[model samples]
Target: MPQSAQLTPEELVEVAQKISELLGGKVKFAVIGGAACSLVRVASDAEYRGTSDLDLVIQPNKSYNAEVISNWLVQKHPKIIRSVEQFGVRIPAIPIYRGKDEYLVEIEIFDVEAWPNRQQYNIADTASNPMTTLTFSPDQYSGSSGDWKIPVMHPVWLLREKILSQYEREGSVKERTDISDLQIMLQVVDPKSLVLSAHNHVTALQNLMAKRPDLINKLRRAIVCYPVFGD
Candidate 1:
């Protein structure tokens, strides 16, 4: 398979909107990974580093798993989408194209239930928590040609995921970007709120804290660096 080109933040939103439309309103999904960070950055007016592919976590219903969704998507729009390619084995990803022959970004789909350590991270509530669910308006941030409201992984959860990724993929090329994203999210999210919310998954929090002590220090510094002033 040829390497797909990178997509700007705006283009990512445009592609997300198309995917949402294709999936229809019944399917529940949220944008995660670098694509989610791009949306958050655009919404926060922070600089967005383009992402190579969009990561989406979908809640498969009785009828739809990653494979089923991919097949359905291709069947729905055969001309626009070339094909859905399966990648990886442990945590398989379905990469769906957004164009016929050439595309800027690829959409990588993952089943939320099948995601590794789903219970540890409590990832099922990714879109359930209103606080951690960011809605990206195309008109406001992307200037896209639709009123599409994209569901994104909010900074609090995103921060946890990034820290985990940093630890898991240590010394890899992606680790640097994960660290950079963590820095950006720290500036945007409330340390106190994040810590309080983390209590819901004590074991996961403990494991992460134990594995990545530097992240704990970063969170500690975040409290002082971005103090919340009371009115």
Candidate 2:
């Protein structure tokens, strides 16, 4: 298999740990995307699928800049030799190497204070709230390095992200994966609770519920039909 192929869950953990170590315990961020779904699977014993990259969302203050994070990686980590573009856009990323395995470590800064007006979905409104930080549950691993502390998003919030992405791109391959991930996650989390959280946070899910009323029901059927414990 080529080194550029899919990343193992073990490798994701190692990259996360190494990134934390490189930051000397100063940086704290939320883990998201497929890698996060993989981590959730490991922790919850859900179905496993691998990812090709690690996505991070660092809460930005006056001092933290997203562009500089890529430069800092180049300056600091020997394993991360250079920075690169994400999806051909100038999103900050560094090529991470874990022995024969290599993948891009994509980073984004979440600054709710200056969220672009054009991109504000109700879910984004909740997620980008400068005041609300995600809390990791006891069931999940805290991917900390040394004395550093890293927070993991709640399963509900993570699902919100997946749903938001699927909503944004209806039939993309990524949305298909997001749907699969949501099924697995729903097995462990109460859908009602997740919906309530969205409601409390003023998410677009409220509108989604009214507009496509059977969305959650369809997802529940998807999970029920899942091959892991199929009908």
Best by lDDT: 1
Candidate 1, which ten residues in sequence have the lowest lDDT sum? 222-231
The models' CA-based lDDT, in order, is 0.63, 0.52
Give the alpha carbon lDDT tens digit for every residue of 1-231 in model 2.
223446665565555555555654444456666766776775676677887666655544455544455566666664554455556645444465657665565554343334545232213344442112322332233454333233455566666566666566665788678777866666666534443233322343443444456565744433232221223
Judge candidate 1 at residue 9 and give its lDDT.
68
Candidate 2 regions exceeding 4 Å error are 1-3, 79-81, 87-150, 196-231
Enumerate residue pairs that collide in model 1: none
Candidate 2 displacement at residue 50 in angstroms: 1.3
TM-scores for every predicted model: 0.71, 0.63
Residue 24, model 1: Cα distance from true site in angstroms: 3.5
Give Cα distance to truth, residue 135, candidate 1, Å.
Answer: 4.9
- Candidate 2, clashing residue pairs? none
